[model samples]
Target: MPRVTIKEIARRAGVSKGAVSYALNGQPGVSDATRARVLKVAEELEWVPNRAARMLSAARSETFGLVLARTAKTLSEEPFYMGFIGGVESVLSTKGYALTIQVVPDLETEMAAYRKWSAERRVDAVIVVDLRVDDPRVPLLQKLELPALVVGDKSLAGGLTCVWTDSTTAMTEAVEHIAELGHQRIARVAGPPEHGHVWMRGQAFAAAADRLGLTGTVVHTDFSGDEGASVTRQLMTSGPDRPTAVIYDNDLMAVAGLGVIHELGLAVPDDVTIIAWDDSTLCRITHPTLSAMSHDVVEYGGRVAHHLFELLDGAEPAAHLNSTPKLQIRGSSGPPPA
Candidate 1:
């Protein structure tokens, strides 16, 4: 049988289509008995509201666009974007909105994708992530007057609203926690320096270490586990005074560093302690669970969506979020060995 319509429900319930609409929308004017009858009929027939028709009648696309800066091949190998996108999509689905996601290799290709989405009127708004210092997208978004939100703290205040985690605070707290563990020397496996968060967190790490009366060093990499393992090996193997505690920008590298520690015959929380940013299940599954600065990725995505809706409503306001990442102690961190 075909899907039931409101008209069929109204006919079966001996009511007008307008009465069915009123009852379905919970609007007044229909008698309680008639409303109940219409609703019962609709429920029995399994009728669903036509979201597409509703959006079209309102002259709105009810969709948003996301353009990725990496190639399709590279995207599959990365877990961060996948988890982040999943969170974003979950919120969009609940709001009866659609997400138009595209992948491009470079800035030029990303620009082309943006143009195509704009020319086709495919999205009501756009979300830009992985912001770098002096990103080209800043000027482009301003020129287009696009309703956009950036995921990092860039100098786009006059042009675009931004949503950022307090990477600086998180990094600072991680270093301080290690210092509290009596760790005097600290090292960080940091993301690329161009990215705004990476730079901010690196600077904050230094400041916090100084405040805590400790030494800090940061090794910049491409946010890859391979780079993390290599850097950890070099940092640990070739030093008269190697760091007793390490902080990582992401979980993948932290997991990789765990392997390096074991291979070098080092005991975690004994000879070395590790704390990672962006906690995930991989941390818990390791031999000794990794301690980390944790935040809710799902909630972060929902917040971005909430702000985008505000922007779409012609609200010319600036918004920034500094999510406080809390330290979750596990088997990976402890007081310095006596």
Candidate 2:
């Protein structure tokens, strides 16, 4: 028996060889109906993809790229991403794939990296993170016709496959818990408002505070320790009506805020309540261990990477919600001062 070629399939399907190629490689040129017909005909012929030939023809790099718009130091200190990358690596390595990570300083550089990676086929796909409101990267990745797994809400990704964590629920729960503890004045140390999750959390914070009749203020910061510390100090000393509780967007900022609270002669849970997101190791190591919104960040990363592979296998784009964060009460949180 002779091996089947795309040409034979094309001839039998009565479509052009180009259409057959597109259908076989799962490219966008052929319509679904036409692709289905081609696939059916190919199936009748018992056609199988030549892995080596397909790799060359489809320009499979067997690599996925993740570009971060942060310094190397930032990546090192950030526990969420570290665990996530490890999780992603666990899958990629098992599948005989490579993960190429790039650290860029700005969106421009990050976009440039995407363009270069796609054009050169340096990566077969990518995982997009830190999605901002009206994210330009979504459309760009689509324009480039590259496979991407957006680790953000579908609203932010604009039609990309999303593996998102529900931050709104988590933020609401955090605020409600603080309000229950009799904390009247609450301040949230949020990440930059331009980021989608950060903005969602802020909205949840405000809504929950208003509903619970608590004074709420959300201070946007850059998710940096310095900024976290600075904002904590400013909030603590700016006036007599200082916030009794602070919810940080990330564990790094929360840890920094804890130090700031101590420096200002305030104590955790007693004078000031602290809640950190991601529940990374920093949260556990802090004195009076930080209360946190806990979720398995490493598992989250694994889910995102796994989704990307599914997209590669021709999975349809959709929103996939991962595990929600559960508020873990620790020493950093208690009933507000009487």
Candidate 3:
């Protein structure tokens, strides 16, 4: 459909273009009756303001950007981002703002997106995710002077505004939950070690395992279901002393791991128990519902968006700790097999 223009509105309302502009903009030049008439005509025509023109004139795009450096396949299968983005939109839509999401294959392309958005004044702010140690994006975002909110621990935020959950604490709790159930051998299927959260969780898992006198193993994956299944097979068959409990970084991988374990003719909890991060719907609906480090991920995303809006409102850059994910026990986790 063609865009409804001010001229078209003016023609229909029996007014000049200048009068239409004044009426639409709620300027002093337009009388109450004229404004009402112009609005009615615009409503009839389904007219909407040109965002680009509004941005140029007002110097505010009212748009937020998020760039994901991950494969489309992985992203489609992962439920965390879906819930997170929904949370972000829940806030953005209420405020009449927009979100621009770009999925790139690597960090370089993701960086390019930030630069382009900043250069073009395309977004009022950006949300940075999957932060790594000494993340290049942090410095680039700083150099570009782009307003950004980092979605990682403050240690990895490089003094930027951040909203994060305590992965270390949560990992400790998860490990303790499994340990209490008499599982001495535990394994974690984590995401890329480069991710700050994964690294933090890995360290915490190791420390907690050591503190509890348990054997701990960690394997890295791309947070894909295929890799999750493959790694589970390897872990289960690699030796006689296999881990009795396995933890996965996301719901997709954990679900995949469950299938692999079943394929190997092992029963959940009775043989190898499973725990997954992010208590998504998949976790709940599985044959044996997964145990998970449960947090309100949608609310977590909303909090991040809220903090970004605060920063845009001239609030100081600071770290806000969201809730730590609590271990939610379900059918998949129990005492190891006798």
Candidate 4:
């Protein structure tokens, strides 16, 4: 079916198009009775306002956007984004706003999305995640003059408003906890090194390990279960020189690593101990419930959405430290075998 136009409404209501417009828009030129008639005709015709026209008249899209430069499989399998998006929607739904999400393969495609959204005026603002060292998106978003909030540390945000958690502090705590548990040889199965938070965490992990006089090593992955399992297998089979304690960047990897440990006939906290980041539900359900750096990811996302609203409301670009993730010890972590 074709869209019902204002001209059609006018013809059916026996009024000029100008009068129909005035009536629909609640302008003073139309009498109450004429306005009532025109509105009734519009309802009967099932007419709806065009989004482009509404945006042109109100200068607001009433929407926000997020583009993830990750594969669809990763997005589907990752629990962090699910909780984060739910948090964002929790705030957006109340304000009569919508969220537009896109998944792309790389940063260049993600940049194209930003440019398109800017040219179309498709979103009132955008939420940028997974910041990189000297990120190009920061300058591109600035050049587009798009309102955006970065979900990263201030150093990576490049003067944009941001909401961040203290990953550095949390990493130190994880290392310290393992050190205190009597594990001197430690390993970290980290996410892609290019991500700002991952880089920061790696630095903090290294520093803390040195401070505690523990031998530390890190291997990077795509934050996938397969890669996590592969890395864990390699670490365990490396000719009697394997880490006694391992920390994973995300829960999926931790869970996968746990399976590989079990397959190798290793008992949790005996042959190897495990820790995961994000503290998603997966942690609790595992056989020997993995220890995790626990934080409210949903609330974290909500804070980012709130900051974007503040920015849209003409607030100054600023950074907010949401909270540091605390270590939630579980059965999977303990002292190494005596």
Candidate with the greatest TM-score versus the true structure = 4
The local distance difference test score of each candidate is 0.82, 0.90, 0.93, 0.93
- In what order do the candidates fall by TM-score, top score first? 4, 3, 2, 1
**How many pairs of residues collide in each model?**
0, 0, 0, 0
lDDT of 3 by residue, 225-289 (tens): 99999999999997879999999999999999999999999999799989999899999999899
Supply the global lDDT for candidate 4: 0.93
Assess every candidate by TM-score: 0.78, 0.83, 0.91, 0.98
CA lDDT for candidate 2 = 0.90
* Candidate 2 residue runs with Cα over 4 Å from true position: 1-56
Q: What are the runs in model 3 whose C-alpha is more than 4 Å off?
A: 1-50
| Clash pairs (backbone) in predicted model 1 | none
Q: Estimate the lDDT of model 1.
A: 0.82
lDDT of 4 at 255: 92
**Considering summed lDDT, which 10 consecutive residues are worst modelled in model 4?**
50-59
